[model samples]
Target: MTEVSRTRPTEIGLPGPTPRDMLRSMRFISREPLAFLGRMAAEHGDTVAFPIPGPPVLLVNDPADVQRVLRTGGRSWSKQTVQYAAFARVTGPGLLAADGPTWLAHRRVAAPAFHHERIEALGGLVGEAVDDAVAARLRTPAFASGDVADLAELCHHVGLDVVGRTLFSVDLTGQAAELLRTTGSAAELVVRQGRSLVSTLAWAPTPTNLRLLAARRRLARATAGLVAQRRDAVGPGAASYGDDLLGLLLDSDLTDEQVGDELVTMVIAGHETVASALSWTLMLLAEHPAAQDRLRAEVAAAGEVSFLRHREALPFTRAVVDEALRLFPPAWVVSRRAREDDHLAGRDVPAGTLAIISPWLVQRRAEDWPDPEAFDPGRFADGATQRPAYLPFGAGPRLCIGRELALAEMVVVLARLLGEFRVSLPPGYVRPAPETLAAVQPEGGMPLVVTRA
Candidate 1:
């Protein structure tokens, strides 16, 4: 066997980075998540082991291995305790981090909001938000831009608006900017705390905890206020949106705290991912004019870019969104732990071991994707490649309950933007990778130059 083949399962594995290098990697994750992960993948092949954590934590980059751990053999794995603990503190048993019966319950409750038919119905709302966002950008004279519109922020606002209007019957557009700041800060704080084994010891009298508590209070207040308003408006029929997520959740016997948790989790998880996907779609389109032309033609042929209409007309737009997601998956890494002793992709995983399945790596693995780095949406169209390798929304029973909603939202937003705006990267702009908290967002936000198409 080759040296790499023989040493693949070693505990320390490869020449691991030193303490300084480790710190640098951590900082890079905080500043440039996607790039740091890509660097790690390059240095170590499909499965790389890190020295931290009680046992060696394996970063699985191969798609087949990813599927084995996340779906095909999920029974052997569970969400990392670290994540569940941190997320539970804020969400109180919400779906994003919950496991077992609790997660299953939350999934059932929130599933309706994301049903394909229901999500399709919400297309008009998505189209309207995207159109308004694009129009806001268009107000800036073409080429007269100095920070015209932050696509990241715009998409965040669009997502918040969609969730509010469709789910809670609220107008969150006004609060979008504030919510963005508050949630982003809270998520970063949570991640910092979760990363350390000694975090709980330091939680007392620490500024991070103090800030985290304050942020949680603010988020809780906002969520409670919205829930109260929705409850009063609906009257006893709390969980009753024909297909709204909140209504289905209300149908369950979960406490108000649980409701608050789920609402905030959805607010944070749902929109940001789709927004990132949309932002990357724009970035990819600007980088490849040919793909953009094909998208524009496909969208133009569709009827009006209206959400309610043109369901069957925009395959290229959907393809572009899917491709962008595959390249820069917003939820880049999924953290899980082995619930029982399990062997995955030829490695023995003891119980309580952390397993990181990253679509960011798997989707672009040299072995899985041909011309892996190329910006080609057509690869996803019909039968050009294996579909299992793509897990942007995750896989298995725990797959994102909001996947359908997210995709519909992306397609509608991209179609509208392509139809109305000539989107491109601002001149001299360098596309930054991302700093992931809850989702991967451009570090300083995506500043793009816009013009009426």
Candidate 2:
């Protein structure tokens, strides 16, 4: 590690390693971003400057500094970086990739659909999807015949189905397989762009670009078809098709392209990240049987629990989810580009600097979390006070809009699965390395053995 000043002084020059440090940092970040960020914070301090080829790049690990950049200094930063530019190809100007007034407009139109009450009302939809997966996939002979099933893939399918039903009131179980393949391909393309400085060349007529274009077209057609169907169904003299998100967008003044962008954004961002979170939660539970047993007991006590109605009663189960998010946040890294010069934690930062915040690193700081690596759900028990340090879903105006939905889905799935079956890693199983494709996910998939509890 290159030696640099570790102290934080008001208005001090940015401190980071030399140019050589940038090359090593890039290599490690490409392979293991969570580890790389954690190591940087540990060796340096909460804020570490890195000498990239272009403008200054700072890795911020302190919660206070993170809040300043994401919450207070939000106006000075924008998502117009290479990271979100890649997402815009697929998501367009939707809430995920949009910034400034466009983002605010989109958020206003879509926020009502994700209200706490509205999301709770969609709990039944989530439960239905999980039940279908349990019956048709998890409990089937193929999964029960001593052959391990990839739980990550299973969750992804169920997540996509849930989002389709809840967002558009359409059942996508039949199209789940194809949608998963297309979305995965598109996601890999975006991840590549995020890692490459030549990301602007993504529009080139290369084979990869062609494949990405084709994938985007397919997804657009599917979403556009749903929007048209809903519009036609609500024409004059037609009965209302209920107020799903599609119905809301159709009733709004958003153009077809804008509507399509939001649809694709919801489909990709809504499901994939939740699936990864659930997968990692399950993996953590398998690794720590005590926590798993406690969760199972909590679920059993609340028989036929409704996530919305009885979530307060299932404290242990909720804590397990919270702890899992802390350890392995699906959206592990959040990046922003400074639109103007700013000060973070009293350190002077120049304009056009890249600010990187890793929830994986901040949550694991020894100062905030005792025995940070231990899988202890009790840390989030009732009256526990670590809110400022916890940011699994991010913070500020740009915080994830689907946070409530994701939490509900995870809680419902975990309760149902752990209540019905015992999940464990297969013998000789090795934890897969984490990959930052779209979201932080296991490189291959999480394969676990399941049997009746």
Candidate 3:
């Protein structure tokens, strides 16, 4: 670990590390990214430099510094990192993978679908999806027998179904399982490739890469099929597009390939992150019975309709979601490559340098969060303090467009689930370690015993 210096450098300073240390850091980053970044921030202060080959890699943990890199200096940076390069294989030149004009154009076309009015109207769809999942679980012998259920798996199904219904006006519950597995495998491959020293491994015809290729092909075919179906439904003389995101993209100037990429990106982004957030929130609530009891009581009193109608009145429920996001942010790390020379928190950052801002580290900083490790929903009772520091969905022009929908899904699904069942971790069960694949997810599924409330 790099030691913290007593005097902060006024200009950009690279904490020179021996070649051995640089190799060790790379290994740590690849093997355990969360631990490596946490240790770096703890031992080397908010800003730490790694003497890696090519451009310097810096991890900025300071909230101000993170803001500078993500917002103020955003125009001077691009998503041209090796990490994003690996992501582009599966995501293509979609909004998540694209930068500059391409990103702006996609964002503009798809923006209206995620508007507050549209999202609010989709509440009923989200509610129906959650109810369907609950009904399916209740039909299973596991619920009747009182056997442990994997809430994480259940949430993924619900998330996928919700995303499908809301975005494409189609129910994907039938294909959710396959989609989840394929996307997971492809995303894990990308993460591995991103961390590898050899960038070509991502494109190599290795078994993993082959699987990723197959997954991409499958996803593209699935999306293209949906696009065709929607187009046919509209008829030749009818409007080219509907109000949905898929409709907007098809109606836009983007090519069919670009439309497919954006659809795939939305499916993966829309479902996975929300599912991860819901899973973690359940795990946290299960661990904290008192909070669970309060939430249950609140849900019972308010009812399902109120989750959307009277959202602001349910501060505690929202806080629980916020706190969970703080501890287990799905998009744990945001990576960017400097496009031009920039200064970050009084330090000079050279063009082409890789800058990483980890919400997991920033949110958990002791200075920003008191008793950072503890699950305290009260911290968010009054809403997020230090806005830049609490970047679960990110900040700036590139902030996640689907954040509102994600939050609404989590709150509604959690309310419906907790209102009906009492969730408890299985006895002698070990907590799953956090793993970064597409998003921060539990290593093993979150297995918990669920009983009717």
User: Which candidate should be chosen as best, given TM-score against the real structure?
Assistant: 3
User: What is the per-residue lDDT of model 1 for residues 1-453, given as tens digits with 9 covering 90 to 100?
Assistant: 011211233564333344445654565555554565666677666676765747657777776677777784347888756755776666667888888777877777777676667665677777677776666655545534334467777787788788886676567877787787788888787777665432274358689878888888888999988777767777874446334666666667888888899998977787778777877778788778788888888877766654433435676777777788888888877778888887765767777777776688788877767998888777877623337788888887778877767777878777777776666777787986566666766778877766567
Q: What would the TM-scores of all predictions be? A: 0.88, 0.93, 0.94
Give the Å shift of residue 305 in candidate 3: 3.6
Expressed as tens digits, the lDDT of each residue in 256-338 for candidate 2 is 88999999998899889989999999999888888889889888888776556554878788888888898888887778888
* Cα distance off (Å), candidate 3, residue 162: 0.6
Candidate no. 2 TM-score: 0.93
lDDT, candidate 1, equals 0.71
Clashing pairs in 2: none
Give the per-residue Cα lDDT of candidate 2 at 268: 93
Question: Candidates sorted by lDDT, descending order?
Answer: 3, 2, 1
- Rank candidates by TM-score, best first: 3, 2, 1
Off by over 4 Å in 2: 1-12, 24-26, 197-199, 236-241, 383-386
Overall lDDT per candidate, in order of appearance: 0.71, 0.81, 0.83
Model 1, which residues run further than 4 Å from truth? 1-36, 72-74, 140-148, 194-203, 236-243, 304-311, 383-386
Model 3 poorest 10 in a row by lDDT:
2-11
